[model samples]
Target: MCDRMPLLGMFPSQKRSPPLTIMNLTKLHPFLLLGSFCLASLATCDTAKANDVVGPLVGAVESTSANFLYRVGESEQPLRLSVLLDGDVVQAVDSIGRQEDDFVAKFSISNLRPDTRYHYQITNTKTGETLIEADEQHAFRTANPARHGNRVSVGFVSCVDIEPNGIWKEMQGLDLDTVCLMGDTPYIDSTDLKKVRTRHREFLQMPDLAELAANTPVVGTWDDHDFGLNNGNGHNLMEGKVDTRRGFVNYRAHSQFGNGKEGVYHRVDLGMIEVFFLDPRYFSQTEPSPVDPTQPTCFGAEQWEWLLTGLRESKAPFKVLAFGAIWEDKKNFETDDMFTYWYERDALLDVVKNENIGGVVLLGGDIHVARHLIHPQRVGYDLHDFVISPGHKRTITELDVFHPSLEWSLVEGWQFLTLTADGTQAEPTLTAEFRQPDGVVNRQVKLPLASLTAVDSSKPDSGLRAHWSFDGDLKNQSVLGDRVDAVAVNDALVVTDGGVSGGALKLDRSREQFARVPRSFLDDNSNHHTVSLWFKPTSLPAHGTSERHFLLESTAEGTESAKSAWHLSLGMRSSEDASKVNLQLFTHTLQPATEIGAAPAAKAQGGFDALVDREALLGRWNHVVLAFDSSSLTLTLNDKQIAKHPLPVPGPASEFGGLIIGGHRVGAGRNFDGWIDEVSIWQGEMPAETK
Candidate 1:
């Protein structure tokens, strides 16, 4: 219902209040006032009370298994707990004593069946009084197994300053197996351990949140607001320079932080997906010298090593790296993010690239908005980071600035994300859906597992018409046996190291170089064909130049004015807009000369042009596929369709010249300065297997 409400309505235009302080509470509407009142009243209860149970039974779930860790509030009387599966009491405990000051009781239940649902209840054993009756049964489902080919859905959100009553209702109805609170779950922002604990109790006392937590397993880490101050890091100063790191670990369910460190960083493995809960606030030092390897880093040495080891060791089909803040550097904001420690961040990505680790995705929170960003050409693939925040709080309108790497962003209403991993096919697929409080899906994207994996050209497929691996030679290794030797135009076109495959042909910008074949492999006018290749641009055209850098082209032998038969070129629209380059595919024929001396012009040219907007990072290999059928032409980048356009007319069938690589013509100015490898031409639409 608040989807249409103005973003400013969520946060009044006034001076901010400190965390745990209720100066802004009186400004909230009646509904929020009632909710806050109930939470405060429950959280303020005395811990030594005999029958009064504060912060009743709460469960922290395992990442990828059917295990649960249950925690409860202070209770003097001995308590009895029971867990039921399919209406049968499968596990039970009695006379469990509460811990020290908080008198909280902790229990761990393990070895349950995967994907199975269970109900739990608690009672006082001394007086046979049911503190939590079976009627209010809390139900939860275990994580799904990877081998079962089932879909595992996990929901995530952050920045729940003031509980939105409807948000939890929406989450409860989603029936997610696991819910990850990325950060700012409760705005404690206090160095006092007692105050922090009380704030967590207040958060748990919310009716909707409590109901959702009871029925669904919850996992989380903390951000600045919950870790003591706004934008606070490991060096944050409280009373007497005391950091709130201890308070964060004490109140949360995380049993371990890295190797004796107090930070709350951990990893959870759910059947096919592994989620890495990162702590960037705690253990992070201020920006150090970029070149100083011994300087303090964002993730200390131990945690960083653990993360690398886990990533290298994980065999899961997907890895979700969850953070409490934005991953990339935002131009407008002066905040603590991965950008501040670019060296360490790049080093982490280098491990993935060098180790050839696949199926990695980033998740973030604390921006108070939801958006999808792509770190262009990180390692071998384009790394995607999804940021979701302000679970039920007000969204920020001014934060909606245009980011070149941003794919989709929402600055208005509150939203949550549901990522579902499906391992039913040959390759696992992950689908992320962002939905509103009313259960309406705002955006959805399905990413294939192959996107994160290395380019494996070893697979055999029957649909492959032509494949130029370019390992050591320009031989076509397709079933058709259409082999063509490379005719190098200049010395600059030579085999070089650093390829997705083996050796790739390198083209220099300062020199004129290209390779051509003797026969026309793509001369067929069937209107169903695919051309796929790997390319890495060394440099973009100068700012005010309409220079056309041809990666591949085919033309008939004629005079200098003769039109190109067909070409795939990277060029700017005009001199004024040279920054916006376009990768265009032109298909047509040269008009027949009226007389022997007359020059030939273009007959009928109609193809597609896709803007090389984001994924075109310099010095990184990029996979591109230009596929067309009888109806439309689709341009795929890194295994995802980036652009598609319907053909206005059927492609013209002309006697084409040989295939040209790295230049427009043999002696033309349109020369490419990059590396090209793994060139393939298919007679029909490119199959998923080929990609």
Candidate 2:
């Protein structure tokens, strides 16, 4: 699945309009035509409520200062913030030049205490009129002092909907350091300034959102819908850019707003992690011609420069590059993901690799599905991309995406991702959980601090024992670089393109199958050697035809003297759901037999089963490894150790006559039906980890 494009026929978003050709917007500015309507809009706002006040919405809380955004009356005017900390009057914020601005001004309240809640309200400076009521719901707190070992948890959700949403209520009960509105806090894909500002007010005033903002600091950026229009780029919405930007800066509160001029690109530090919120849609191009030299860029020119500079200067252990689009190449007709801008993305990634920047994680939204992808050595390290999305809508189930980098993905339930950085450990770790209000976690993964650093990807650490790359012919690309005497046992295997590395061996279960490797690695003296291979399953999970979908097996087959060996396979579960596939590893500790075929007895030998989910297997090449040492044997799926079994004695492998790939030698329906590539073996130990 490395370079596969999403079929896209199965994908269609009703929220977005169809893409259009480039239009000349030089003489088509909407602001000129709508200039007269601003006054009428203000009169309409005044008649709706006589003396209305919008918010004391809180943002960008530090140990000493915090920013308060709100609106009073109808037009731009001078305003003051009345602050109270523990019933004592506090010094007002510094307003030397920004006392009188727009209706919504980001009041920077300074000289405050740390880790303390301060109650505040907005007032008119000229008339000394009280604009807001004295309510504790209008309170905000300063953050704890900045330190390396601070324990911080941040919750990120995107694509806020107009209809009722469960995540907004679910987030209020959780105590998070900060809540990020990744994009589309409200689905107002409008080009009207009046409507944009009005919708932003409604979004901030929602009961659940208002409550969460009162207690916890909020920071965010804009995506397509909120940026101007759905899939709107600079070429299409040249007129609305200024108005939409003004609305964004006036409404959303952030620690920094990218020089306070162009795009909502900023950085927010929560505990040990620093999140660089990127604006991928603000300056995006209209066309999909990624190879063109003179087309518009995704992040524009200025924003791209800022992004690279920020990454170079960051010192935090974990630097999260936040965007509104999913990082995978999955795209549709409506809009493009980061994959369309591969040149720019690769440039940014190459900077991280060449400069040796460590602990960088990519975070994105807007895919409508929760996913965890490990791009294999796109950088020097296997970069982890954790996607959070579709805060209101149910996840899109029709996207049958197959990307080599995708390790984990889910389309069930309504949830948001919570990332916590435990900075107090010897090796600080970043943990992400797919969470719901019911405390149900669909998936959870933890990354050690040292896992995201630089390493030599070309030179693997394990001592190579044998290797096979099936590109029309069996060739060993290991140190030996010799021809492997491998053959199709039944002439059913054929070379198939679209493999992870190159052409791969494809097999069909209905036909005579499996490739026989003469002089198998097990024939050597080493008993603890490891075997790993990349497999792409093509057949659907079977309910009754057979259970064991063998990928690699070296057993006695009731013919040879072998007694104890290993078999790596996919076992069908007992449940009615056929999609819930489980990865299985069967090993003969000390006993042996050929009677246990499909349903091996639970007593004869030990087996470990881990849910790999059939969705991950079909149409995608996944790295599967069996690491066995003297102490234990472990099974890995997509570089993650899923199952392990302990051995009472050493040398548990069965002494089979030879090795078989893609199927059990004697089975009719157990042969694998898909592609296989980069089959490898290591004698002593896997070099720290597999590629």
Candidate 3:
């Protein structure tokens, strides 16, 4: 079956009538012609009934859920409803009474899981025995949890209309936690209930969306078309703000948008990450870009204040500030399609800079194209900006290059970002190698935290360290088998063996293993302190189960016994070859334990690898440092700070006991087999890297 409804041409009737020929029109009496038309109308109605007429896509949200407004057809009949989960029928309702032209029915599904998928459909109850005969399944996912980690992937889209294949395929592969629809999901250009129903129904049939809804979590807000007439502003709706409010009401009822207040903006946590969804239409004052300060506002007074406060108070490591408008630094007024409202943008930017906040990312979609921008200046707070726009439905034209700080622009093609984070550092590496749907190749750029901080330094005191640090094996200054460049060249502290190369660092494997160890190991004197390190192995295996390496302390001796002065050493797995990270900071009997970390690939340069493999790590070098304050621990890698958290500092009890680097493993009680150097420990925090 094609699974599509036949469109009613020029005029719609309950029944199909034979096309009238010239002879029939000329010879037929008026009465006879009228009778034939009446018969045809009846037949058309019968066929519609037999085919299971499906119309109206109502969405309602209320106290008990049934109270939500519904987008229903103006028909005097009850509907058969079937709710599904991933194309499987879960619940069905039948034998409902016919509703008046304006009436709506109600049902509630409680006990729904947050961030999960589901499907549903409705049919004419009077004509079919099944609750919903051949009703196509529409999919949906719940909202995210409130608190999560530092990294998250979210999808945004707008300007959606009836199309050949749907956006769902592209959506599913992204593996996102949430989907933000920035308007035009349905292209309803009229206030007429029928037009809205038709558009909604067609959208429900989109398989891509149906599948997506059944799987990923979804959050939607409206734009002009779905809410009102073309280019709709709040004042233009039929019921004005009332209609706008109702549309939102219906949208919320259908989607997983949380409902304390009725509008689109809301915040939720996905794992360790938190996100704030913005609703610009309802509260917005400006229609087009050059925002009129004297005119009404967008985001209204209340929303503006709320957003400001929310951004300031957010505890998540990363924040995604999003909107519907285009955010191009340089505008093309001739196209009349660029972000507006500079005053508002500046206000938001001001809040971020002044707050001394980190990990804030901006997102938006509207141009029907994907774009990425890295602001050399953080607009307000000497901060750098990383912004991306991945639009939907439209085939991208060319790759656009933008270097605001460098002052040049290039059109490479459409692009996306693969961002990685580990509490301390987050890297957004652009891979232009991945083509857009239209098959255009773009360039990929990698941006590290170190670069961003130096380029966008807002603080006057540039002397303090960033936040984290790394101290690996005592080889050269590099963490991996790379050469030791100067602090000016590469800011991280250096650890190196006396000679060039020719030695292997092996782990003391025979011992008990704890997924995470505390920094108390360094507190030999029972005093509290934090410790961190970065390491590189001479050789690595892609797949294996045994063979471990050590760059720092181990607890293989025994769980409770701190027996031997020959306490512990660090560890690394040979299977994970290349480079690795070990960051542990713990308190003594008095305080708490906290850790922050990240590991980069060990790059081979010059005679580094060759010498390290055959001789002492001559060309190879690694950095190892232990910096602690009485209350906190800080770790860094390659000069880029990693994490700073409260923990028990190393004690003075170890003054009599020697500090060991490649000593015996903690639990295994075996010695580490690797070259060591540049071992340094400070009673105070290490000096901050240069901006």
lDDT of 1 by residue, 51-82 (tens): 22333434455532333333334544576667
Show the colliding residue pairs in model 1.
64-269, 64-270
- Backbone Cα, N, C clashes tallied per candidate: 2, 4, 96
> What ranges in model 2 sit over 4 Å off?
1-52, 75-77, 82-86, 94-102, 110-117, 126-136, 144-147, 286-295, 456-691
Find the number of clashing residue pairs for candidate 1: 2
Scored by lDDT, the top model is 2
Q: What C-alpha lDDT, on a 0 to 100 scale, does residue 55 get in candidate 3?
A: 24
What are the lDDT figures for the candidates, one per model?
Answer: 0.63, 0.64, 0.39
TM-score computed on alpha carbons, candidate 1: 0.59
Return whichever of 1 and 2 wins on lDDT: 2
| For model 2, the run of ten residues with the poorest summed lDDT | 593-602
CA displacement after TM-score superposition, residue 222 of candidate 3 (Å): 3.3
